[model samples]
Target: MIAIVDCNSFYVSCERLFKPHLNGKPVGVMSNNDGCVIALSNELKALGVKMGTPAHYLKEQVARGEITLFSSNYELYGDISTRVQAVLEEFSAGIDPYSIDECWVNFDGFAPGQLEDHARELRRQVKQYTGIPVSIGVAPTRTLAKVANRASKKIEGFGGVCVLYPDSPQTKGLLQRFELGDVWGVGRRLAEKLGNMGINTAWDLRNQNAKEIRRRFSVTLERTVLELQETPAIEMIGMDFARERIMTSRSFGRLTNDKGEIREAIRQHAQRSAEKLRKQGSLCRAVLVFLRTNPHRQDLAQHNPSMIIELNNPTDDSREIVAAAIQVLERLHAPNKRYMNGGVMLMDICERGTEQLSLLGTQQSDAERQRSEKLMGVMDELNQKMGRGTVRIGTPSAGAAWHLRCAHRSPRYTTRWEEIPPVRL
Candidate 1:
């Protein structure tokens, strides 16, 4: 059997971890710049505020303290997610992370009859160890596990764990009742297309001929069709494969024409991208930088420019990557453009040992490569041990325009010593 364990209202649950008093209260977490709601608690959902609703739209409710809103606290969320994954690792035969808040758990040696009990125990232990509530779904296929997991979460009688067998009557009823869009890979548009063909439920899609589905739509959809019929066809290739390109970008706290601030943002992004590249044991041959004005506002003059700069050698060194990024920025930077966003992309990445060396042997010196590796390794280790940005490429300018506007952010209760919660005796 396969199982998937998913955290419940993950972001809101993380916030509530520190402030238990907020339990059962309406709460939402916003996106970067606190622009719109991205995570919602059940209480918040009951209050009719939806995902992506503008944060300003809830100003009156916030003013009256009816609902609490928080800026996206990635540091806290990431730490909690790691802790949860660790707990899962201790129990299951094997665990594969589906996302920060979800993982696929394999039950290889366990008895089928005890799967639900075992899954419940897994849920209990995760809560006991991490103080985070999780829901588990067990089924023959990963897709059905996802469906059962959603049912366990959204249904009340299941008590956080639901198990379904391919031939079970309960499974049949579920597939019949579930909307086609709720199937693992079906989206709104695809569901609409399937709906027109009378494939309006999970059962209907499962009944379709897989080859016909492939001919009509795509191989991926055909895989989903087979998966719905309890065949495991979807392979998480993207999750298993190393990324071909790495990108880091974000909207600024406020728009600015200051070249220094734009440089600062791109510099940070390059440093971050380089960190990822090294972590994956890959090197990039080029760095791409782009600057853009806010596309939503029409009153302001607009400019979006991008440039890619090649490095002397394919490398994962932060210094070289940041230098290449800055070169691109310098060439693309247009004065008085009031750029609201900037980004860095590491392109043409390959495994460290597989990079094509220049034929002339006229590349970064051997000693320089060794030193870069040592320095970057030390920097990564220090930052990992002492928190990110402890040993960064450069000091960020105070009041930099690229800084995020997270005015209502909660403390980094788990990751930062200074932000850890206080106890009253």
Candidate 2:
């Protein structure tokens, strides 16, 4: 059987972890630049504060004490997520951390009664450790477990854990009630198409001939539906220990006709990407730089250019990544054009130990790599403990013209003292 463990109101719940007074209040977390709502509490949802609703539109709600808004506190949320995952790991033999607030666990070889008890224990442990509530759903298939999870949300007596065994009456009822769109892999477009064919419910889709579904739809859809009909075909492997590519991108607060500001933005992006590479104990063999004018603004002259630079050797050294990034920047930059966004993407990444040295040119000396690694380690440690960007490259300074305009951003209350949120008694 597969079990899905999902956190309730994750971002808002993270805030409530330390501030228990917000238990029954309407609260939400804003997206980047404090532009819109990304996470909302149950109270906030009931008040019609829809997800992705711009904060500006909710000003009246804020004034009326109808909603409390918070900036995205990634540090606090990440730490809490780690704690919750740790608690879950203690019980389940295998776990797939699907997202920040959701995970899938393998529960095979366990009896039906044992599965129910284990699910309840998982909820209790996670709540006790992280002060956040979670819901667990168990079924023969991952898709059916997801349906059981939805049903659990409606039944308060379930205590946040629901099991949908294959032969159970509740499981059959759930399949009949759930819409096709509500299934795991079906999106709006596919759901509408399926509904046209009268495949409105989960059971209906499951009962359809697998080969007919493949020929009518696509191979991917057919496979997904087939998996949902029985036990989950996918298996959870061990954790992802290897690092991948590192990237840094952002839209500027204002359109920049000046080339100097564009260069500054690219430099800052390169520096940020380099920092991320070092954090993951990885190095880059290629760097990609790109810039674009605001496509939405028809008034501005259009210019979109991107260039990739291959390195002579893979290196975690910030200087090397910065140099390669600048090479691409020079190639992509256009004259007499206003650029609205610029970014650096570090690719062809590999672990520090596995990186291949330049065959022709003398490789970066051991002392040089060691010095850079030490500096990056110190910077990472400081940032991890004190908060991100507390000590960062001066290129992204407050006075930079390319800085994002985040006037409505809430203070980093848990990370920085000066920017801490003010609490009212």
Candidate 3:
């Protein structure tokens, strides 16, 4: 059997791990620049505070201490997620991470009857070790496992564990009542399309012929249909680990029309994107730079511009990528337009050694290629060994205007030495 364990309200749960008093309170974690609600606790959901609700709307509640909000603390969340995965690894044969807060555990050797009890103990161990509450759903397929996981979280009687066999009456009942949209991989859009076809419930969709669904819609939908009938169509991991395109973007701490500020942000994004490409063993042939003015600022004149520049040859070198990004910036940046964000995208990427090189002099020579590779390797190694940004191109300014605005961020408790939680005397 396959099982999925998803942490309940992951970000808020992480924040609550260190602050136990906030366990049952309304809490949320804000997006970059305190933009909006990205994660909310059950209490906050009960208060009708949905994801993506602007943070400014809840200012009064924040001040009154009715609801607490924190900026996204990715470092703390990542560390806590690692801890949870480690605990899960001990219970399962192996694990396939679905996201930061979810993992699919392997239960190959365990008997069918013991699955529920083993999953319950796994959840307990995760909570005991990492202080994070998780819900587990075990079933024959990943899609049904996801459905079971949802039930574990939504239905309290299961006590955070649910097991479903294909022929079980419980599975049939749940499938009958569950909406089509709630099925794994079938969002509101696809659900609406299926609803038009009279497939409004999981049971209804499962009854349709898999080949007919594929002919009407997609191969993915066909797989979903099969998975619903207790067939495992989806792989534990998605198609591939390598990304076809890489993008790095973030909002500025404060809006500015300064060309230098725009340049710096684009440069940083380009450098980061290059790092990702190298880490994935890929190379890009083009760089895309985009600059945006705050769309919400209705009072100001707006200019959103973007441009793409083709490199002489595909490369994963930071210098080439950043230079191309700056070149695009020179063309895309506009005068007297207050910019709020910028991004760098590496496009037309391929596995590192697969592309054909150009014969033109614009491409790097043999010696130059060796030098660039060595330099980037050392830079990445130093950054990995010491800390990020240990070896960077150009001078980096700590108090830059383009930096992210995370005023409400909690400490990096697990990752940073100085930010560890204090003990009472």
Candidate 4:
């Protein structure tokens, strides 16, 4: 059996964690740059405040005090996610962290009949330890686990836990009632196609000919059909691990055409990517930089260009990566173009110890590599102690025009000492 756990309204819940008074109120969490709603509480949803609604469009409602808003505090959310995952780790050894707010646990060791009880216990512990509410679903396959999870939350009286056993009457009834689009991995396009064939419910899709579905659509759809029939089709593969290439990018707080600020942003991105690479014990053989103007700003001359620099040797050293990234940025940047955002991508990654160096003059020497590693290690330690950016290759220019707009961010209650909740005298 497998169980999937998902946090309920994670960002909004995290905000409510430190501010209990906000519970039961309509609240929405904004994405970066305070642009749009990324998460909303139950109350907010009932008020018809649709997800992805732009902040500027809600000015009247906000001014009328009808809805409360918050900027995305990723640091706080990330720390809370870590705590929740740690509590879950105590439950099972076969854990696959599906996302920041979701995890799948293989319950092979637990008895089939006891799965529901174990899920309840998990919910209770997670709430007690992290103050985040979660819904759990248990089934014979991961796809059904996802379906059960939604049912647990949506079905009245389910009490935040649902289980669908193989060859069960209850499972069949639920599948017949649930919509096909709600099934895992079924998007709008597939749903439309399925609907054209009179397959509007999960049970209809499950009952379709599996090989016919594969031939008509894709092997993935066939796998989904099999899983819905209570046959496991997917296995957890490298859960919570780095991808082949790592990229970090963001829109600027405001539009700017300045080259220096653009370089700084690219450098910061390259530095962050290198840190991630080292953390994953990998090295990159290429660095790419790209920048673009805000498409919405039609008044400005727009330009978007990207360039890649391939290294003779792979390395995780930030200095090396930043140098190559800057060269690409220079090539990509054009004068008179109003740039809005830029970022760095590290590709062609390989395990650190497996790097093959060219037997030529350009290869980094052993002494140089050791020196670079030591420097980055110390920098990382200092930043971890004093907070990020305490030690950077070149500090992001103060009051840079491209700084993110986070006007309503909450205190870093969990990660920073000064931001910790104060006690009454």
C-alpha TM-score for every candidate = 0.97, 0.84, 0.91, 0.94
The most accurate candidate by lDDT is 1
Q: For residues 219-296, could you state the per-residue lDDT of candidate 3 as single tens digits? A: 999999999999989996442489989999998999998888778888889999999999988989999889889899
Mind giving the per-residue lDDT tens digits that candidate 1 earns over 361-395? Answer: 73457777888899999999999998999999889
Kindly report which residue pairs in candidate 2 clash with one another. none
lDDT of each: 0.91, 0.80, 0.90, 0.89
* Per-residue lDDT of 195 in model 4: 99
CA lDDT for candidate 3: 0.90
Candidate 2 C-alpha lDDT tens digits along 1-425: 88888899898888887678889999998886577899999898898879999988998978888778887777667767877888887777877888898888878678877989888887888888778998988888777888778777777878788998777877767778888888888899999999998889888887898889999988777866776677455554434554577779988877777777777788878877887787667888899998989898898789998888898878877677877888888878888888888898999999888877655544456667678778878877887787676666554556565877655444445567786667789
Worst 10 residues of 1 by lDDT: 233-242
Clashes of 3: 0
Q: Which residue pairs does candidate 4 place in steric collision?
A: none
Candidate 4 local lDDT, 1-425, one digit each (tens):
88999999999999999889999999999999999999999999999889999989888888998888999999999889989988998877567888889988778888878888988998999999999999999999999999999999999778999988888898998899989889999999999999999999999999999999999999999999999988889887655466789998998888887889988998898989998888888999999889989888898888888888998678888888999999888788887888888888999999878888767644457778888889988988887778777787787887786788998999999888889999899
TM-score between candidate 3 and the true structure: 0.91
Measured on C-alpha atoms, candidate 2 has an lDDT of 0.80
* Per-candidate clashes, comma-separated: 0, 0, 0, 0
Model 4 regions lying over 4 Å from their true place:
240-242, 361-364, 381-387
> In candidate 4, what residue range of length 10 has the lowest lDDT sum?
357-366
Ranking by lDDT: 1, 3, 4, 2
Looking at candidate 4, what is the lDDT of residue 389?
72
Q: RMSD to native for every prediction?
A: 1.5, 3.6, 2.6, 2.0
**Regions more than 4 Å wrong, model 2:** 108-110, 236-246, 253-268, 275-283, 330-339, 349-357, 361-395, 399-425
